[model samples]
Target: MTMIGAQLRLLAWFVIPATLLSGCAPAIRLDEAATDRPIQTSSAPPAAREDAPAPHRPPSPTPTPVPRAFALNLYQEGDFVPQYTFDWCVAASIQIMHNVIDDTGGGTWADRVQQGQLWEMARARSSNSFNGANPLGWAKVLTEVGMGPYAVVSIADYGEALRTAARAIADTGRPVGLVMWRGRHVWVMSGFTSLGDPDQFPKFSVTGIRVQDPLYPYGDQQWGPSPAPNALLTPEQLATQFVVREPRRWSSNLPTGYMLVLPVAKA
Candidate 1:
């Protein structure tokens, strides 16, 4: 009888615990419950545009800047003591030209050319035959220094080089003139004239403006107003002319038979 009573007590204990556990709700899963919460949605605020500057537009039909005689005098000093070698001078000039432009202000190539200080700096460096005669090579150097004009590759194309240079000159707003020397006589471009023949003396413009003065002995001439005179020369022409005419001229300080001066177009 006592054994039967003890067995009944043990069974009662097991049953009570089982029943209590089964009656309880699953421990509310906090992770799942949180996931059931709704997501909040609101439109993001628009970006601020208060401090933005206006976009820049390249000037079209820009004016060309003319170099003053005083500036020319800076280059005409001494018997052309060439500092720039054909290979090195052209490279150095392009770099220095762009640097000076950036130092003064950030604007189009025309803007830099118009600046007297930049012109003096460029002329001083480029005139030294130490640079190369190949303008395209010079363009490569210009790119490194951040003074590229975008269309500089045109120089590789004979017909396009002069036009490209002309356009760049015009954009620079500097003296839109060309300088050339037949022998020791240096002439400045004045204006273009339709010589009636587009071939030999092609129907184009001419550059010259002689100032009569004995003290100065002779004055420089300026040329311009033509839409396209550079069309005459092709890329092969430039390479051939510069390369063939005087293979050693560009490399040396001695005059390379002829000297051509090209200025930026008038702004």
Candidate 2:
């Protein structure tokens, strides 16, 4: 009987714990709970570029474009006039300038009689010019006859001289008078082609020049040949004939240099 009672007590203890353990929500083990979520991993950063500019320094400024090809021309079909006589070069040049600027259909000033009268007018206004029209006389006659407020200028440097002439023409819309062969002859620079626009850039260079030589087809032996009218001559070609004026060749306050009958703005 004692053995049977002890067996009943042990059976009751095992059955009661088994009934409590089979619950509505099961308790998960530590290893089983770890596998419920996905594993998270970290990676290294990318390498930097070697060619990039420094972060602390400011960026450099963009440079202005140079040798940007440009051209400006004022020559027309009928803007050329040949000299009536060897001594009437300036008069013919004045006539050509009048023809260029006038733009009116009928009153062309290329008549031989009119050219002679203009020569006389220029010569009458000059002094210390040996009875011919000098630069002063040429400028004065232009002013009086309503062609200029022109003035005489001398530049020591050849490149600067071309630049000055180009700038004046671009500024005033008038022709530049080049005192060719040391003030003995004259050629009118009607327009020019440059590396940059003269009106826009102060540092432009003259690449080619358009000239009107009154003595075309009759070039001098000592000096170079006269280019055809409205010829676009390079600076080197022009340098062959264009030289420094002799100080004693003509009387002026200007020192010995390349002479130009430059046009100035009217005040």
Model 2: per-residue Cα lDDT over 112-191, one tens digit each = 99999999988887764477888888888888888789998989999999999999888888888898998889999989
- Model 2 score (lDDT): 0.86
**Clashes, model 2:** 0
Q: lDDT of all the models against the reference?
A: 0.32, 0.86
Which structure among the candidates has the greatest lDDT?
2
**C-alpha root-mean-square deviation, each candidate:** 21.7, 5.5
Question: Which consecutive 10 residues in model 1 have the weakest lDDT in total?
Answer: 71-80
Return the TM-score for candidate 1, rounded to 2 decimals: 0.25
Worst 10 residues of 2 by lDDT: 21-30
Q: Tell me the tens digit of each residue's lDDT in model 1 across 132-152.
A: 134323333344444443222
TM-scores, one per candidate: 0.25, 0.80
Q: What is the Å distance of residue 8 in model 1 from its true position?
A: 99
